[model samples]
Structure formats: structure tokens, C-alpha cells
Target: MGVSLRDVADLAGVSVKTVSNVVNGYAHVAPATRAKVEEALSRLDYRPNLSARNLRRGRTGVIALALPELDAPYFAELSRFVIDAAAEQRWLVVIEQTDGSLERERQILDGVRDHRVDGLILSPIAIGADELAARTDETALVLLGERIHDGPADHVAIDNVRAARDVTEHLIGLGRTRVAALGAQDSAVSGTAPLRLAGYREALAAHGLPETVVRVERYRRADGAAAMAGLLTGGDRPDAVFCFNDLLALGALRAILSRGLRVPEDIALAGLDDIEDGRYSTPTLTTVAPDKAELARIAVDLLRRRIDGRSGHAPQEVRAGYRLMARESTLGR
Candidate 1:
């Protein structure tokens, strides 16, 4: 038979109520008493019956993490951090990929009514403010990206405009006058591309430079390569390129090198999201590195607050920090 709370309480010379308090993370227990109870728990290898405890508390002891694309390095890395954060809270995480589909995202939102999980952390790509506002599932939700701003949920994201501006400014400071931006999108449901484009434009206007943009259907390496190829052949070659993400930047690097062009010599390049691939690329990559671990931690913490009824009536919009990592792609190795 498994060791019970009674066994721990008996070994600690305390009542079962005191043992239960410590197990449940109650603050009323004295420090010394808590330590003693913890020692007793360890000695007996007493594992709490999570199922029974959750049943009593009316919770599932689980949370859902919904992201647009699990295959994206940024999202994959962020998911790792979120899993670690949720583990600290003793909560299991179920990850769902929406593939950036509006209908698929809405279906996940509607699934909240099923109560399969206690809360949700979502990095939306398609759903908008109206869709979020119309949600009637009453599930504790925390937004992870710039998809739906100021909606009826806690939001955690980096300052996309500022991050983009900083990367663009890095190229300008390198004396690249003809800087072009890749990854502008026509979608009105997603805010990431637009916010980044705004930042790029802001930097250009501040520097008295012309604004050159390449619209992309998606943020992928192929899109970046194709756009770079077009820029090269279209007779308006930019001396520098700022891709919205590292994958695009890497793709552009390949296209430039395939044509025997030197990076940061003939044309400097920069991007956002410092994924691992950026660091190990041929000339490396100059990119903006958002505090992804911190973003995940904050998102998980906010969701836990909502799940525990500790959040206030008004939703919170928290901005994570980021830094521009100057590497060989722009500065030369």
C-alpha cells in the first residue's frame, strides 16, 4: 500500500490537518513545522494523491498551451520553457497546434467548455478581438502573443514595434542606407507582422531613409529566399535586409550566398527571434532575442493566477523584454 498523509503526520509528530496544510501549500503553517513535515514526507516517500486532491478542489490539475505553429523554432523553444514553468506549479500541460487556421483556433477556444483542462495559454495567429470578446466558455485564458490585444484575458508579449525598430536601427547604424523589410502580411487578424512593419517604418523615417517592404504570405525560409531573389533581380537591391524572423533571414542568407554575394559586405542582414539556427549559420545572424523563457514563465504564472481566482477583474497586459544580438550577418564575423 502507498504511504498516506496519516503516515507522514505520525512520523512528524503532528496532526493529519497540519500535514495536509503543508501538502496543499498553505501559508498558515509555521516554517519549522513545515520543514519537519517536509522531512517526514521525504522520509516516507509520501506522494500526495493528486487525483483525489484535484477532485476535491474541482480542478483537473492540467492546463492547455495553444500555439499557432509548433514546428516554428520560436514556438518550439517557447513550449519547452512553458512546460518547465508549468511543472514548477505541479500542473501538466497539453499542447495543441492550430496551424494558424482561424477555424481551428476557434474550435480550440470552444473546447474550453469541455473542461478537459483548467486553463489555457494561447499564442493566437488568426482569432481577433471580436472573436476573443465573444468567447463564452469562461475558461481561464492568457494570451501569449500580439494576436488579440486588450482582450478579455491576460496578455504576455514583447514590444514587437520596439524590437523591430531596434534591429532596423542596428543595420542603419552599420551605414546600410537601402534597408528593406521582409514579412509584411495582408492579414488583419494577426498583429505581429503589422507591428513589426510599423517599427521598421519608424526606424526608416527617423533615419530619413526610404521605406521598402516585401509582402509575404507566410514567415518561412522559402518566402524569405523568394523575396530576396526578387529584390536582387527587380533592379532595386537593398544594401540591407531585416527579416521578421530568423528562418526568413537564414533563407535570405542562402539566396545571397547562392548568388556569390557577401553578407555585411555587399548586403547586411538582420532578423527577429534569435532561434538556435541563427547562431550556427554560416556568417551567423544578427537578430532580436526576446526573453522567451521569461515570456513563458510570465504567461504560465498569469494563467495560474486566473485558474486560482487570484487575478483581478481587469485583465493585464505584460510586455516581456528583448535585446538585439549583433552577429556576423550584419557586423561581419
Candidate 2:
């Protein structure tokens, strides 16, 4: 009844395929063809039928972004970036949480065949390289964070080990020997936690310091608070603490303040992933800044390319470097 894609294509003097490409936001379409199609659509009042488009393209025009927790400011900001990137290409984002569980990761992977989304950008928890290699055949999977294995799929991440080493070195340079490592873990698959922890240990080794006082946890703000509280009361009190993330660092900040201790003056604190809230926090968080927007841009582009059958470009392992932003939290005013 209403204006159709056919009408727009016919009016534009282009093949239906060309019109489809234009509507789908394909990057390869010429500007002239796109302009003509757009003009014809506007003239005919032709609206896109998303359902029909999905059927034609055999794609849902949706991508899944599986993250750990949206409550964390970093994940929240990361989700926003991914959503914006996908939206520019006329794609939708479906967010999921793994709760840092292996079973949940498996379930998310199994869901790819259901047509909920054409691809996935995963911040997998406890997922191994073998599992990803087996599951990524049907859907385009872009792995994010240190949890992902260096296997198949395009990866977007920062060099966590180097970043952590730099953070530790910075603390060391400040003459803080009794440095406490917060959020340490024995192992993590598909994320930067393990790598960063390894770097922390490496930094300690480099400085000829003991790596005995690591506070392992699930990397939550509460966990940071609890870990810091334990360290404060325990016999081995750290002169400085390096948390795995800003949320944890914030928690530690609260714990340190409650003890009537001055930040940096009593115990210096630092963290990674310089989230938005970190900048505004009292004694603003000192953290490793990753270019989240750029990471999102690359991830969206990579998934789009994979879905479009552009496999000539090999799997890209883009590691965005981190910058140590010294703030009030680490440097006593």
C-alpha cells in the first residue's frame, strides 16, 4: 500500500541490490548512488521496513554486547560507546551480562544461532580460547578485554600487563615500597585481570619487592572495601594500593577515609579504566585511561566487516595503549 523499496530503486535508476545496500548503510556504496536513492526515498515517502530488510539480508541488524556488570561505570560507558557506534551503521545493540560465570558465557554463545543478533561483542568471563574457537562459526564474535583468548575472532583491548606495570612503576618511583595489589586473581580467561595482575607481580619483581600481600577478590567496589579493610587491620599495612578498576578504587577510597587516613599521605591509591565518575570523585581517581570511544569504533567496524563477508582482512588484534593519569587520589594535594 505505502511506498516500497522497489519504487525508490526504480525512481533512482539503480538495481534493487544497490538500493538495499544504501538502505543498509553499507560502506562500499558510492555517494552518488546513495544520494539518488535517498532523494527517491524522500520523494516517494518510502520508509524502511526493518523486518523486510532483516529477511532480505538474512541478518537481524542487531548485535549483542555481553558485559560483566552495567553498574560499573566503565561497563556502563563502554555499553554507551558500543550502542552509539552500532547506531551509526543502522544496527541495534542487545546487552547481556555474564555475572562472571562460565556457564553464563556458554549460554550466551549458544544464543547466537537464534537470530537475536547478527554478531556479538563479548567481554567474556571465564571463557577459554577453545570454547570461542568452537562457537564463532555461525556468528561474528568480537572479543573484548583480557578474558578473551588469543584465538579466533577480532579482538579490541588495551595492553593490560604493560599498563599495570607502568602503574606499579609509577608507585614505585614515588618511593612506595609496601604496595598492596587489590583485586588480584589466580586466573581469568578472556579479560585483562590476569594479565594486569601478572604485570603487578612483574613490577614488584623488577623492584626487588615482595609480592606477598595481593588481595584477591571478584573486583567489586565492596570487594575493594573489604580487601582494604583487611589490609589496614592486618599486620602488613601497604603504603600504596593499586586496584584493578575505578569502582574498586572508589571503594578503597571510602575505606581509607573512614579510617581517618589521608589519601596519598597515608596510603596512595591507583586504579585502571579511568571512568567518567572517577574524574569527579573526591580526590579524583588516578587510573589508566583507555580510549573507549576508539575501541568501540573499531569493534563496530570489525563486526560489520565480518558480517559483510569481507574476510580478506585478517583478524585484527588492536591493543589500545593506556595512559596513567595522576590525580588527587594518588598525589596528595
Candidate 3:
């Protein structure tokens, strides 16, 4: 027969109830008892029956992490951090890619509530307050971005507006005018798109500069490159451009270079997210770097707390930190 909890308890020299308590994450168990029980479990290679345990405890011991696109470097890196953070709490993560589709996101919410996961960490870009408000799930759902801020869920985010404004201001401080904005596909909506654009405009208005933008259907390298190329070939062009994310900014860089335009001399560039690819680009990108690791940690922590019924009655809002990373992309030195 396969090893079981009883065998682990016997090997650990502890009562079955005591072993169970340790397994259930009961803090009252002494450190020595926990260590002994854990050692026995390791030796016996005992894997708890997750389904039975979940039925008894009403917890699946797993959380669903839903993002728009798994291929985006920013979301990919965020998933890595969330997985690490969740593991520290003895929770497994099941990632679901929504492909920025509202229908898929809604389906994931329903699926999570159907007992597939104990909680959900959602990074919804296409979903809005109306969509979120329509749900009646009691499952612990924590949003990972500012797009759905008004929904009835705990949220973790960076100050998108302030971060965007600071990066735009940084470009302005470098004496670059005729600045154009990129990555605002739906500026009328109450999401990251509008919030980041609001920041960009504030910086421009403060400097007494007019706003010009190259809207795109998506925030990807190909779209960003296309937007910049069109701007360059047109009668109107920007001396500096603020892309909403690193991917878009990197795309614009390629477009800038392909046309034989020297960076920061002919066109300065800035972007958000400060992704790893941005750090190593030919002329290192100047970006508004949000504390992505902290964002993941906080979102996971909040979701865990909600699942444990430890969070306050009201939903929580936590804004992670951000900073402007100025480098070769916008400077001569």
C-alpha cells in the first residue's frame, strides 16, 4: 500500500490529530512537532489527497492567476514572481491566459468559482467595472492592476498616472518638445490606457505643449513599430515619444533606428514597465519602472488573506512603488 497520513504520523512519533494539525497549517503546533511531522512526510513521500482535503477544509490549496497575454514580457515576468510568492505560502498557482479577451476572462471567473481554485488574482485589461460588478462570486478575487479599480475586489497597482506623468516630464526636462504618446487604444475607458494617457497630458499641459498621439489597437512591438514608422514618414513627427509599456517602446526604437534616426538626438524615447529587454536595448531605454515584484507579492498576499477570512470587511487597495529610469535612450551620456 502507498504511504499515508497514518504512516507519516506513526513515523513522526506523533498522534494522528497532531500530524493533521501540522499538515493543515495550524500555528499552535510547536516548531519541533512541525519539523518532525514535515520530516516524516518527506521521508514517506506522502502526498495529501488534495480533493479530500479541500472538501474537508473548503479550500483547494491552489489559486488561479489570470492575465491578458502570457507572451508579453511584463506579464510573463509578473507570473514568475507570483508563482514564487504563492509557493512561499504553500499554495500552487494555476495560470490562465485570457488573451486580452473579455469573454475568456469572464469564463475564467466562473470556472474559478466552480471550485477549481481557492482564489483568483486577475490582471484584467479589457474588463471594466460593469463586467466585474455583474459577478456575484464569494470567492476571493484580487485584481493585479488599476484597470478595474472600482470593482468590489482587493487590488494591487502602481500609480499609473503619476508614473506616466513622471516619465513624460523626464523627457521634457531633457528639452524634448513635440512629444507624442503611444499605447492609448481606448482612452475613453476607465482603465490603464486612460489613466496613463491622463498623466501624459498633464505633463504636456504643464509645459504648455500640445498633445499628439498615434493610437494602436494593441500594445505590442509590431504595433508600436508601425505607429512610430508612420509618424516618421508623415509631415508631423515627435522629438520624444512616451510608450505605455516596454514592449511598445522597444518596437518604436527599432522603427527609429531603421529609418537612420539617431536616438536622443533626432528622437528621444521613454516607456513603462522597465522590462529586462528594455535594460539591454542598444540605447538602454528610459522607462517608468514599477516595482513588479512587490506588485505580485502584495496581490498574492492579499488574496491569501481574503481566502483565510483574515482581511477586513472592506476591499483593500494597495499601490506598489514606481520610479523613472533615465538612460541612453533619452540622454547623451
lDDT of the structure predicted as candidate 3: 0.88
How do the residues 154-248 of candidate 3 rate in per-residue lDDT, one tens digit apiece? 99999998998998898889888899999888533556888889899999999999998778888899999998998898887799999988899
Total clashes, candidate 2? 8
> In model 3, which runs have C-alpha deviations exceeding 4 angstroms?
6-44, 147-149
Which candidate gets the maximum TM-score versus the true structure? 3
Candidate 2 weakest lDDT stretch, 10 residues:
144-153
Q: How displaced is residue 229 in candidate 3, in Å? A: 1.1
The sequence of per-residue lDDT tens digits that candidate 2 reaches over residues 1-333 is 677788888999999888878877999988888999989978998787877767876888899999878887888988899999999998989889988888888998888778879999988768888878777457888888653545677888888889999998888878888987888666565457778888898999998997744555587889888888888898878888989888889889999999999888888889999998789988898899988888888888888888888666566787765689999877843
TM-score, per-candidate, Cα-based: 0.86, 0.86, 0.90
TM-score winner between 2 and 3, please give it.
3
Please give the distance, in angstroms, between residue 165's alpha carbon in candidate 3 and its true position after superposition: 0.6
Q: lDDT per residue, candidate 1, 1-333, as tens digits? A: 688899999999999999999998998999999999999999999998877777777888899999978898989999999999999998899999998888888999999768689999988888888879888888999999784566878999999999999999989998889999998988847669989999999999998999899988777899899988988997878999999999899989999999999998999999899999999998999999999999999999899889887678798999999988999989842
**Which residue pairs in candidate 1 have backbone atoms (N, alpha carbon, C) closer than 3 angstroms, thus clashing?**
none
Our model 3 lands, by Cα RMSD against the true structure, at: 3.2
lDDT of 3 at 209: 94
Best by lDDT: 1
Ranking by lDDT: 1, 3, 2
